[model samples]
Target: MLDYLVFIGTGVYLIMQTLGGDKVRGLTIELVRFTLAYSFLWGAIEKFMQPDLFYHLLEEHSYLAMGMDWEFFVRAAGFVEFCCAWHIFSGRAAGYAGIGLMAFFVIAAVIPFGMIDFIGHFLFIIPLIAVLFTPRKVPLCRTACGTTLAFLVALALYLLVAYAAWYMLYFYLHLDLFH
Candidate 1:
């Protein structure tokens, strides 16, 4: 589900970027940022909520398996993901956030899932690279009140869209997402 969203989002971003216009470039950057941010946010929430899934993955799948508790590692990774998502979403040090996310994904792909994971996540690499190369601009919200409001609105939208997507996949399409 998340992979579909990121793939579609990256395609749209690439099309917009290829159009060759200033407004298109700006819009592409913003949209890519939103897509990446939402992806990371959803992943972080899922990891935190279902630590057992991560624990099992670490136990059975991961190559560079940690010696410490799996639950603790899951929580720590979730926290880091949340921080990167927040920074990217808020347009505060977004370039750095993009770099961080890219690094994390690269490491995760190599360490656990290998070439398959890297290929699966190739679409995401474009948007992360775009964000890293793009210049940082002022956030949509300037003032404190506006920033707070924007964050709330973004969170609400993220939840709504995520739920709708999940519902469509699980209920309408009869796909088992958690398996």
Candidate 2:
């Protein structure tokens, strides 16, 4: 799927950043961070928008919700995701977000949906590795305006592509967006 391909692109960018990428390191890092933040933002919003869908999935598959009520589990999952997304966007706890979210996707989506879920949601794992391997000396941003522009652009792109993918699923593929 197109979303999975974006992972490949992200991986390539990550690789470039790892290997003497002084050409655009600041911009690249900012873009990667913002893209990831916006991606998680979309994820949290989707869950909040359709809690019943996740609740039913948890009810059916029961991914170690720790004996919690399904409704509470859904809300907690959304809140966790929302908070993590904010923290990552704010650069407060990106490493923790990467680790926690990678585990969450595996436990919540991949375990229930099988290979398709892995294919669709495995991108978060890359961030797990990225945060672990990031160089300590982060490059200083060239300008506040440039950083802001990248954040806005990443948000727009993430929103547009996500909705476009949802549209294809809802229309051409005859799949429910939140069912």
Candidate 3:
């Protein structure tokens, strides 16, 4: 059920991002942006409001011992997440920001939680690659390192934006793969 929901969400987001026509794309982008931004913003607010929640989670998982002040890091992460969401909707630096955020998430998952959540984050690299490789602008010369870098960055962004799709594929669409 959750997987299905995430699939739907990812599908909607991709369609919205790739949709043509300025008016339609603008509206769709706005809608997607608002939703994405609000999600992270709310989460940031929540974490700020309830500082102990993260602390308790850390303790429960034995990730870190008691009395570590991670509130600043948590707040900064929330701000960055919110910014990444904003960038995606704006279609400006979104591609780069999205990819960077995904990488950050992957690192965070592996270093803190071990390999448990790593699988989930690792699967996001696929859609990201697709999005990155999709030609956005015409190139004067294809050999430019800048172009390749752009593609890589875009791939990263795609991974971040389409992460729900990965989750859906792993958790719901095809359970056997993960198993």
Query: Over the full model, what C-alpha lDDT does candidate 1 score relative to the true structure?
Result: 0.69
lDDT tens digits, residue span 1-179, model 2: 33333355576667878885799675665556556655666666566556777777776778557789877777777667655654455553354654576456655766557887776666766654554455335422345565456556655665576677777767866646456
Residue 26 in model 3: lDDT: 40
Candidate with the larger lDDT of 2 and 3: 2
Runs of candidate 3 with Cα error greater than 4 angstroms are: 1-6, 11-46, 60-68, 122-131, 134-179
Clash pairs for candidate 3? 99-156, 128-159, 132-155
Q: Against the unseen true structure, what C-alpha lDDT does each candidate score?
A: 0.69, 0.61, 0.51
lDDT (Cα) of model 3: 0.51
Best by TM-score: 1
Better of 1 and 3 by TM-score: 1
lDDT of 3 by residue, 66-175 (tens): 34457765566555665554444334445556746755665676877778666654444443434344423433224546545654564456445456554675598777
Candidate 1 structure quality by residue, lDDT tens digits, 18-134: 776677877777778778777777887677556788777776756544566667778888767766776666765544854676567655676556787777677667667777777
Can you rank all candidates by TM-score, best first?
Answer: 1, 2, 3
TM-score (all chains, Cα) for each model: 0.70, 0.58, 0.45
